[model samples]
Structure formats: structure tokens, C-alpha cells
Target chain A: MTTTQDRQSAGVEITPLTAPAQRTANTAFRGLSITAASLILVTLAAVATFLLVEAWPAITDASGELADKVSWIRPDEGQSLIEIAGYLIFGTVLISAIALLIATPLSIGIALFISHYAPRKLASGLGYLIDLLAAIPSVVYGLWGAIVLIPVLQPFYQWLADYLGWIPLFAPADDGTVSNTGRVALSAGIVLAIMVIPIITAVTREVFLQTPKLHEEAALAMGATRWEMVRMAVFPFGRSGIIGATMLGLGRALGETMAVYMILSVGLTYSFQILNAANHNTIASYIAGQFPEANSQGVSALIALGLALFVITLLVNMLARWIVSRRSEFSGAN
Target chain B: MSKRIDVNNLNVYYGGFLAVEDVSLSIEAKSVTAFIGPSGCGKSTFLRTLNRMHEVIPGARVEGEVLMDGVNLYDPQVDPVAVRRHVGMVFQRPNPFPTMSIEENVLAGVKLNSKRMSKSDSQDLVESSLRGANLWEEVKDRLDKPGSSLSGGQQQRLCIARAIAIKPDVLLMDEPCSALDPISTLAIEDLIQELKSEYTIVIVTHNMQQAARVSEKTAFFNIAGTGKPGKLIEMDDTTTIFSAPAEKATEDYISGRFG
Candidate 1:
């Protein structure tokens, strides 16, 4: 009461609800924050527009003068830009798919081991070690894959072709031999798998750690063994999170360039013999290897290939969001 | 299926600190027993020791004998997991597995162990368990919906159904209705009255009225000060404890004269 009377005596009045406040630190921070956020969207739109404008002629003018000069893309057959993109899309997807299949289960195992099995004193240290794998440069991985990993895998590839030659995937090329050099799609995919494990493991470890305590107790109180309890509560709770993490890894693998280009013995073969040098090549590596020697038309074709990769990555991201969101709505804690 | 419990020289510890010290008590089979105490008195801790649930927390251990039907649950040959199976538990909050449908939630105790059940047998079991918890009428049609879609009261009852589905000999409740409304508490109290005829029911509660209303026997626990272990102070019939407690501290706590 004294304060109110003092305020009235001092001729102070409450501000109206609609009255605007004077400029303050809050307004400045909010302005800067919104600008930074919107800048990302604006930059994304600008890049997409630029790619679309630059790649239009190469994509539309299939038999024009520029498309004629866009050699090294089936020069004898005169394949259009869309056809070449479609061909490269297969290799990009095949490599990332292999990476996803190998990385997803390994990441899940490492995450669970870190989150549930490791002792409290050692778990944090193991987690930091896993995250450190992501910090290694891709070029270093490329060098290691080419120099050290290839010789170790060459005998193994030869053994697979010798023992499992009847299977079409391990069957030799039409020239009648496997890659004694081990610079095959299988090795490139394995290298990509090693590179993306940290990404998937990081997201999945945090999700597994966030499994609700009450739910875990509820399962354990039911006499569930430790693994059973994890299967019952932790796995279901982290399912959508696992899917999202795998998609992130897949996106990273799809756009990877230096390691794949450095390690791959680039050749196009439709037989899908993964243990051979003459196999499909990813769009990123194709562009990376060819960009320096490319003309104006060749550059546009490469940008168009990049646009295809961007579309594929966008689709995978959308699919991840759809699955995660749909799962949360259907059965997650409403 | 109810069985009596005999606890002798029970001491619960978290790491090196004793939480509940040297308690001895016998609970009658087929009746409701309530443990009442001030906050941090370890009533809930002692309750967890009954089913070996406290060991889920690392370094939490108990030194004592918890005998159910003349068998020592703490014996080296006995598995804690088997003990929990025979002694079911319900927590304060209603925690039906959110990812499961109502029917699946009821059968989780059996299914999560990977035991096989025929389709018809599981259906019958679901009906009987939900009926046993008095929730069949409300949720009969939507057993396919997620367990989390229910109201708080309904979810608590679903947890009760889940607990009873395993056909345990004893049921341990740790402040099961503390997070519920008065009407829901009454509903649970009435359910407890119904359940005590079939299973040995031990509950820890803060509300004296709830203890008086639902339990036949009451035990009072107290702590002298912070950092001191909680001890069981008195045990008697509910009427005797409320109206004429033998211990002065019990009388003070019952009569609202507590410090």
C-alpha cells in the first residue's frame, strides 16, 4: 500500500497493456537472433535459385551446341543431362545404402554398449572417444583407405570371388577377373561406413540415455532381464530417433566427395559386381574428379548432378521427419 | 495365492550410508498393511527391499532376510528377478508403457519375458486382469488405443491390472495414490480393499486417513534427524494405532502433534 501511494504521489501511472516498451537489450538480441535464423533460409533459397538458373540449358537443351560439347558423359551415345544424372544417381544411392546398412546396426550396438553396459566411470570416456572419430578429416580417411585398407582387403576380395563366385554380386566382370587392386565399390562403401558411424552413434547414444527411468523401472519390476528390459522399453522409445540418426548418416554419406574420389578406381559397370574396379561411381566423386577440367557446359552438368543429390538428400530428410512425426503421433506419449 | 512376509534384521543401504536400519516385522497374508511415516523416513525404501527393486540403483544393497512363505529371497541361490516376479510392484505415478496398447500393457509382464501365449488365451487373460482391476467397463472398447491415452486414474488402474496379470503372491505399492485426486484415491482404496482378499498387499502412505481407511494393520516409521537412519517405531492394528497408539511418537504423529 505504501509503495502504491508513493507511486501515485509521485505521479506515476501503470503503463497500458498495448503500450510499446523502449528499446532494450532483449529487443536487440531478438532482432539479431531472428536475422541469423532467417539468413540461413535466405541463403538456402539463393543457392537453389542460382543452381536452377545455371543448370537450365544443360538439362533442357538436350541436343543443343552446349550439350554437344558436354563430352565425357557417354559422348558416343549422346546421353542427355537427365539420363546422365539418372545413371549417377544409382551409384550415389548404392554407396550410401551400403553405408546405412553397415553403420546402423554397428552404431546401435556401440550406442547401447555406451549407454547401458559401460560402467559409470568409463562410459563418458568411451563416449568422447566415439565422438573423436567424427573429427578426423575425410582426406585422411581417404589416404588411409587407399594406402593401408586396400591391401588388407584385396586378398579378402579375391577370396570372396574364389569361394562365392556363383553369387552374381561377387561374380567377376565380363573380362573374367575381380579387382586384384581392391579399389572397388565395396571398399569405398566400407570407408564411407566408417566415416558416418560417429554421426549415427552420437544421436542414438543421447536418445538411448534419455529412455524414461520410470518406464525402465516398470519393465524391471516385471522381472525382465536386462536385455529384455532394453528391448521392451529402450528400443521402442528410441526407434524413431534411430531412424532419424540413420537418415542423417545417409545424407552425409550421399554428399561425401574427397574420400570416395580418392579411393575409388572410377569405372561404370551395370552388373553391380561390388568387388570389381569397373563399377558404378557416385555423382559427388564424378564431379570432384571432373570439375577442374570442365568447360562452361560441363560445369552446368555437374551443378545439375549436384542438384539431383540435393533433391535426394532433401527427400531422405523429409522421410525421416515423416516417420518420426508419424510415430510420435500414433503411439508416443500423447 | 497370498503369502505372509517375515523380515528379520533388515537394513537398506545406499553405498555406505544406512537408509533403513535393522527392522523386523511380519506381515499377515491376505490383508492390507500400511506403513506411515514422515518424509525421508524410508518407508518407501523398506517397501522396495521387499521385492529387491532398490538394487536397480547402483550400490543400493540390503542386508537382511525377506522370507516369503518360509523361503529367504536374499539367499545366494535365489534370483532377484524371480523374487520380483513373485512380488509385483506399482509405483506412485501411473506408468503404463506409452508405446503399448491397453491390451499389450496388461500383458507386458508376461510378454516382455518372451513367454508364448495363444491368441485366445491372451485375450482371456487381458479381460480377466482388466476386470480384476475394475477397469474392464471403461476400457473394454478401446483396448487397442495407446495406454497413455487414459486419464490419470484410469492409467493407475491399468498399472494395477498389469501388476496383477502376472499372478504374483504379494503386491507392493509405494505411495500408489499419492499422485492421484481424492476421488481417484478413494477408487484405489476401494480397489485395495478388493485386492487384499487375493494377495498380500503392503503399501506406504503419507495420508493417515488413507491408512485408516484401507489397511487392517499399520506400522509407523520415524527418523531422529537428518543423516540418521529411519527406524520402524510401532506396529499395531489400524484402529489401535489411530485411536490408542502404544508409542508416544505414533500418537503424536497420528494426532497431528508431530514436530
Candidate 2:
């Protein structure tokens, strides 16, 4: 206030370059933007710190009753939190890997169909429907997976067990008794695959559409068929983009809880039998299913599981970022 | 493999609009012909029609016939893709596949079509094509580098190499040097001289001096007004067209008069 009055009394502004009034406005905006940007970093740090604090007791075995009635979650005496986390991660990685394997190719094919094959009007309508698919609530997907998808996949699982039992991953039971229900990891994986398709497809379609026209024309001028041109120009240019999109889908798949929790009959066995009803458990679905009935220590242990999941997803996203940035080095020159 | 092209009453259209109307000209084999005109005069469109490339545009089509070695290119039995395989093109801008290295970019036409060749054959073809484009010496040590890593001039030459690797009979250049600097333009002009010994060359250029220098024969195209179809005003030996043009529009365009 004093400074303003003093400057007014001087009867002149700093007329050299930047105006004093504009500088003040600039400073205020700079502060506002800085605070807005720092809020994300600060919130991230706070969440990480809180997770560490809460999970420390379970990790160090300070919290008694870590192994309560739910021995499946905490395991036997003195089993380190790392081992529990490893089991959860294994399950999480297994189901999402299956989902990714199923989703990525399907998404790429669908993206290509929309971008290159379909008529323009039909393509737009199809794209809109896919985007709408992406917007459907996860809880709704959970319900659909439980009531609709699981029952539909039961016959398929039995057929796999009947003919393809030699593949250890698809084996139903040693006694050859076919499970009546489809509440298995394989079913959960397919549900997750369906969930991530729209997300991966939408991203890859955008990237494919952004392919440089000059390159496409070059290929066509050289007598390439449409498929060949897409192979030469579209696929190569959109490689990193597809990988990044798949990673985003993977991130969502790994952290997805409601869909998996509803579809899966969870158990903590180390069996790789995906067709079996009670073999493995993704960390997220496990947490969701067990959190409500958990003791204080049990909840702490679950948070530790969440921390492990957080680290894995963070690594996935970072790997995606690195891949995208690496492509830009050569990408920008063109 | 060089072949003469005879275009008869060619009319190019984009949907309902005629772009270039009733252009009939003979392009000699193993010689360079230049098409020169102002912007939007359809010189580039007429050039693309020789190789059926104008049809690549949606709703853009051609009427009448373009004959190469007595085969009508616009015939119902003629496949456009097969036509393009024999008649390659270089655009106004340099476009090398960014994802491919120099060696892959050189072999892109063959490799993308899944053609199988032994190691030695591919190595020889890459060498010969790059040499033909006058780019082998500068890029020999870095065949593994991405094509996008090359300078603008070198990338254009790489594109030329890719086009010729398919062994097309007629090569069409649409303002190939417009995007290049003067020195690079000279380099390409010199290249067009050597390339014409084995391939029929047709170029569309906005620069009169470039057309005068590089072409054996020159064709001038003109439009009456905007949205009107362009017509070929005159075509003659490069020396005669520049010295004593027959058409008033040709003389006017050549002498800095109203075109």
C-alpha cells in the first residue's frame, strides 16, 4: 500500500520495458500457476508418505494379529511382507498379462479397421460407440461380468479342459472333474480384456490417423497395396504410440478392482491353472474383497499390497513415457 | 525399360469440377520434358495423369487415354497399382520413411511387397540405386542410420533411390526442386540428366529457368480463370519455346507479361 502511494506520488511509471502493473499481474499469475503445479507433486508425496507410515507396522510385524482368520491374505508365521506382496504381484501380473495379450492385437485390428478400412461415415459412428464403451462405469462392467460373461464362458472353459488339458495353464482339475462355474482367472482376464479394448483402440486409432501423409503417398507411389502401405508407413510410425496405449490399458487392468472382484473366486494358491476356480488373486481384487472384514493389522497389510501395486503401475507408466520420448527423437526430424 | 508416352485428349476432374481439359501431348522416351505454369494451372495434375496418379485423390478421375508403348493406361483392364509399379513419382517435398534406416528405405518398395532376394543381390541393388541418385558416397558409412536423420537434399535423393529401385519405366517429378535450395536443385537437375538415359522423365516446375535448363522439350499450360480447366497452350523444343513461342499466352508467360 505504501509502495503504491509512493509510486503514485512520484507521478511516473517505470517506462523502460515492462510495465510495473503488468509485472505485478505476472507475479500473481506465476504464483498461482506454481501453486497449481506443485499441488500434484505435494499430494503425491503426501500419499506416498502416508502409505509408508501406515504400512510400516505390518512390514515390521509390529502390528499383532497380522495373520487373523484370513490366513490366505497374510499367510503363515513370519512370512515376510515381501513374499505376500510377491504372490499378489504374480497374480496381478498374470491376469493383466493375459488381458494385455488378448486386448492389444484386438485393439490394433479394430483401430486399423476404423482408420483405414471402414467407410468414413460408418467409421465415425463405430468410433463413437467405442468411446461410449469406454465411458461405461466399472461397477456396471463388474455386474455384467458376474451375471453375463462368467456364465457364457463356462462352456468354453469346460471345452478347453476337455481337449486342451495337456496345457498346464488351462488344466481344470487332476481328477478331470469339470467346474460348473466360470469364476476363474481366465474369465477375469477376458473381462479385463473387454474392459481395456475401447481405451487402447481409441488411442491407437488417433495415432494411426496422425501418420504423415507424405510417407503414405510415397508408399502408394511405389506401387504398394493398401495393406502394404499401412505396414510400411502406418504401423512403423505408430509403434511407440501403440506400446504407450497398451501400457495405459495395462495400468488400468492391473489396478482394476470391481470387475475382477466380482468375477473371480479368489484364493492365494501358487497354481498357474487359469481355468481353475480358486488358484490366484490379483492384489486389487484381494484388497477389495478382504478390506471390510479386515482387522487393523490386516488393513495395514492390505495397504502394503497396494503400495506394491502402486510401484508396479508407476514403473509401467515410466517405461511407457521413456518409450514415447525415445521415438520423438527420430520422429521430430521428419 | 524407357518408354514413350502419348497422352490423347486427357481431361482431369475432381468430383464435378474439371481440373485440366483436353491435353494431348507426346513425351519422348529417354528424354526429359518439363511442364511449366503458374500456380493452380494444373501442370502437376497433368503430370500425374501420365502415371495414373491423379486417380489417387478421392473422386478425382481422368477421361480419354494415356498410352505407354501403345497400351492405353486408362483402359478398364489396366490395373492402377500395376501401372504405378512401372511409372514411379517423386513429390514436391522429400518424404523418406522415418522408421526405416538408409538400407531399408532403399529397399522399401521391394521389402514392403515381401519380395525375397539373396544378400548379395540386395547389397548390389542398394549400391547401384544410391549411386544412381548420387547419394552413395555421402551416406555409405551410415547405412544403418534412420532416413529422417539425413539432410533435406540427401533425403530427397534417398526418395529418388527408393523410386528407381522399383525399376519404373517412366519417372515423374512434381516440383522436385521447389522445396530444395539452389545448390541441391543443381544437384538434382544434373541427376535428371543422367536418369533420362534409362527412364522417361517428366517434370512439373514453377521455375522457368529450371524447365529451360533440365528439359529437352517444354510444355506450357494455362487457365482462363479460377475454377476453369487448364489447357496446354504450347509445347516445343526447349530452345524454340523459350526463343520463339507460338501462342500469345506462352510468349506472355515467358516474357514477364500478363499470363
Candidate 3:
């Protein structure tokens, strides 16, 4: 009878074992993955901490006075956080909301057309064209909006003021005249809509294309029309994905800097009149416009404004995630 | 509501490739007819053509006349959607819309046509359909639950309930039990026998025993080689097809000699 150690050595020689090399490689891969994941978390935490440190001066300077800190009704320049960014915050939300309202339906339609309605060759060509639009820089969009679209949309703005002035959103300015320049929140929103369409369409199209074949067939076999089939099968299946895509577009519109800065005639007034060119200013545009000329206190104030924007976007994304999770059970994507 | 089906020189094609060559057969009203064949034999394709469901696929077309009670379904004036309404289908794998509740799933076909029914009537219809599919006892208390919450076998019966709620003249099943467990398969087989009294049933099955057990008439399809279109080899009473087939291919296939 052979000893156990001698038998093991013989078995190892026969098997040609690479266990030692495999174990080393496996440990190294696990370590690398853990390091990469930790790096991301650490980087995010570092950024947040830096923002807080930069913004502390503004937050503390306005602690004693209610008027300078959080009051939207008054403007003061001496304190670091004077003139609460209420209008900037509201303008960002309103403009982005407008962009999403205009883009969501159109993006979903284009996505549906690409996935279902259009012929195969035409659909792929259209998809490539949409992706190309996404590849275009925001500055180009701004320049085009300022030069070409502003002038072209002047008459449409006049028509809205003339015919639909009873609606507060489309009403004329306080001076009883709509701005002929067309540099307004509506215009910026339209530009943002054009900017965000490709992203939403790409995402929604992917989700629509992923509708299971069996579910689609089930609808078809039930005598559903093409549109009805989309309602029953495609839309329900892609509901959460559509919501997620819309949220992504909303995020882009909220943080969009160059396009809004170049297009909108910036204003500091707290007003809800989107059609008024003299009453629009978003946080991103404010930052880009004021950063170059800002003193130390002003810089801290701007960082505070940026922090507010970061918080708002974080809240919006969290809300979107909650909605998606709530609907995941019915979505059947899993 | 059952109806006879008459096929005349049916040929199925996908894009430029022929999938099934010219074939013709008649199916009696209120009877069970099973198509038995090996894989890629186009039995499922032929079944889909009976209800105009094959046309849903891009570039999938059929050159044939599928007459249901003397009406040609392939006529240009006759809408495929209308054809599908009259001839419902059950797929191989159960696909109850996950977004819909069990009751809503049963009413899907009826609702797709935009037909208005009173709440009581709708509830009645749902109950009867589920009872018809032999699923009411298991699912009655949880009719509001998502259809996908059911087990695989129950989901298949729910699909059967959905199909029958439309009260179609004919029902097409594409290997409905192939994805089911042995016990579930037996349950569906029993349900198919009961369904034949109310609906003209056409099933495409790969299992020879299932074909013998559930079908009254049997049709066998065969292909000569790879890349060749499938053809109907023979069709006869199930007893005769399994006992003394007219074609050698059918006999060999039934006897497990060769596909």
C-alpha cells in the first residue's frame, strides 16, 4: 500500500493541475474589482466634501438674517448668500419640465416608429441619424437657437400672446408687449427639448425593441390592432424604462449650461411668465455667467447655488428610482 | 360557434425562402385535429396561417385560401385582425400579460375589440371562461392578482381562459403542452378533449403519444433534407395513422424509426 502523500503527489502529476496559478489570478481579480468599486465611492464622497467646504462661508454668513439667506422677495448684495436662488431654482425646474413635456411624447413616438412602424432599412437609418444628432455639441445648438430659431419663432410667440394671452403662461409682458427677440424660457426649453430627444428616443427604442416576442404574439393573437398591441404589450412592458429615460432627459436639461446661457436673455426676476424674455434665469446659466467675475464671497455663493442644484437633481433621480421600483413588478422586464 | 376549416394549396414563405410547400386538408367542425412532425416542419407556421397570425411577422406571407365556413380568410378585403378575432390561438409557452390581473387577462381579447360589457357581465364572463379552462377553482379567490403570479401550468390555463373568453369559432394551439410538466401536460390534454365540443381545435404537436391521445384526426408533415421545405405527408383518422399509415415516412416517424 502506498502512503497518502505519495499517492497525492502522483495524482497531482497525472492531473496537470494549475490550481496555484488559478487561485492567484482569482484573488487578484477580486481585489481589483473591490478597489475599482471603492474608488468610485471615495471619489464621489471627496467631491461632496469639497463642495461642502467651499460652500460653508456662504451658509454661515447668512445664518443671522432671514432676509439675506432664504428670502426670495428681496435682493441684497453684501452678504455671501444674499438673494436666495429661488428664481434660479424655479426657472430650472420649470424650463426642464417644459422640455420634458414637449420631448417625452415626441421621443416616445419616434422610438415607437423606429421599433415598430418604420421599415427595417428606414428605421435603422433614422436611428443612426438620431444618434448623430446626439453627437452634436451643445454650443452648436445654442448658436443655432440664438441666430436661426429665435428669429423664426418670433411670429409663433406673437401668435401665442395674441390668441392665448388669457393663459398666464403664454401671456404678454407687463408692458403689454411680448418680446420680439424671442429670448425667453420657452425658447430655451425648446432648445433643451431638441437636445434631449436623442437620448430619450435611444433609451425608449431599446426598451420597446426588448418587448418579448411571446407577449407581442399573445396580443396579436387576441385581435389587437398594431396600436392596441403597443398599448397592451409594448407600453406596459417599457413603462419603467420610459420613466427612467425621461428622468435622464430631465437631468440633462436641468444641468444644461452652454445652450441656456447662449440662448436665453438672462434675467434675475422671480416670475412665472415663461413667455417674458425679461423674467428667466436658470441656475446653470447663472453660474456660467457669474463665475468669471465672482469675488471670493461670490464664488462661495455660486458653489452654494450649485449645491442646491445638485440636491434637486439627486431628489429627482431618487424619485424616479422609486417610481421605477414600484412599477418593476408589472413591467415584466426581469 | 365551432366551424370547419378547408385549406386549398397552402404555401408559406418567409421573405424569399419557402417554408412550407403546397398542401391542402379539411378539418371537421367541433373536432380535434393534430399535426405531428419533427422540428422545422412548419406545422406551427401552418397553424398560424389558419388565424392570419403568421402575417404579423415581417415578410411572412402565405399563398393559399384558408376557408372558414366558406369564407376565404386570405381575401384582401377580409382584415387579418378580424380573422384573428374569429380564430383565437394558444402558444407553446404560457404568456399571460404580466401587467394585467388574472380577470383582466381573461377579458383581454374581448376588451381589444372595444366591446362594452357591464361589470356583472364581465365578471360572469371571466368566471365562465376560467371554469371552462378548469382554472376557476384555483384562481377564483385571487382574480385581481397579476396573471404572472400563477404557476407555469396555471398560467397556461389562464391563457386558455383568455382565448375562450372571445368565444372564437376555432382555436389553434402550437404545441401547447410541449413546455409543460408531465402532470400539467395531462391536465391540458384533458382540457383539449372537453374544448373540442365547443370549438374546432387544431394543434401542432411533436409528441406522438400526445397526438394519439388528444386528437381525433392526425396530419403528418415531413422534410426531405436540410434547407428543403416541409410537406404534408399524410392525414387520416388518428387510429389509422398510428396503426396503418398510408405513407412510409409517416409510419417510420410514428414508430420512432426516423424523423
Best by TM-score: 1
Superposed model 3: Cα runs more than 4 Å off: A1-21, A63-83
Which scores better on DockQ, 1 or 2? 1
lDDT of 2 by residue, A1-334 (tens): 5675688689855464554455778899999999999999999999898888898877777444465534554445556566667778989999999999999999999999999889889999999999998999888898999898888889988999989988988876978845577888888899899999999999999999998889888988998888998998899889888998999899999999999988888776677899987778899998898798887777888888888898899999998888878757456344
TM-score of chain A of 1: 0.91
RMSD of each: 2.2, 4.9, 3.2
Off by over 4 Å in 2: A1-33, A62-65, A68-81, A322-329, A332-334
User: Just chain B of model 3: what TM-score?
Assistant: 0.99
TM-score of 3: 0.94
lDDT of 2 at B143: 91
- Ordered list by TM-score, greatest first: 1, 3, 2
**What part of the reference interface contacts, as a 0 to 1 fraction, does candidate 1 reproduce?**
0.62
Model 1 ranges with Cα > 4 A deviation: A1-3, A6-23, A174-177, A330-333
Give the Cα error of residue A59 in candidate 2, in Å: 1.6
- The predicted structure with the larger lDDT, 2 or 3, is 3
Q: After superposition, how far is residue B57 of candidate 3 from its true place, in Å?
A: 1.9
Tens digits of per-residue lDDT for model 1 on B10-50? 99999999999999999999999999999999999999999
Model 3: residue B17 alpha-carbon error in angstroms: 1.4
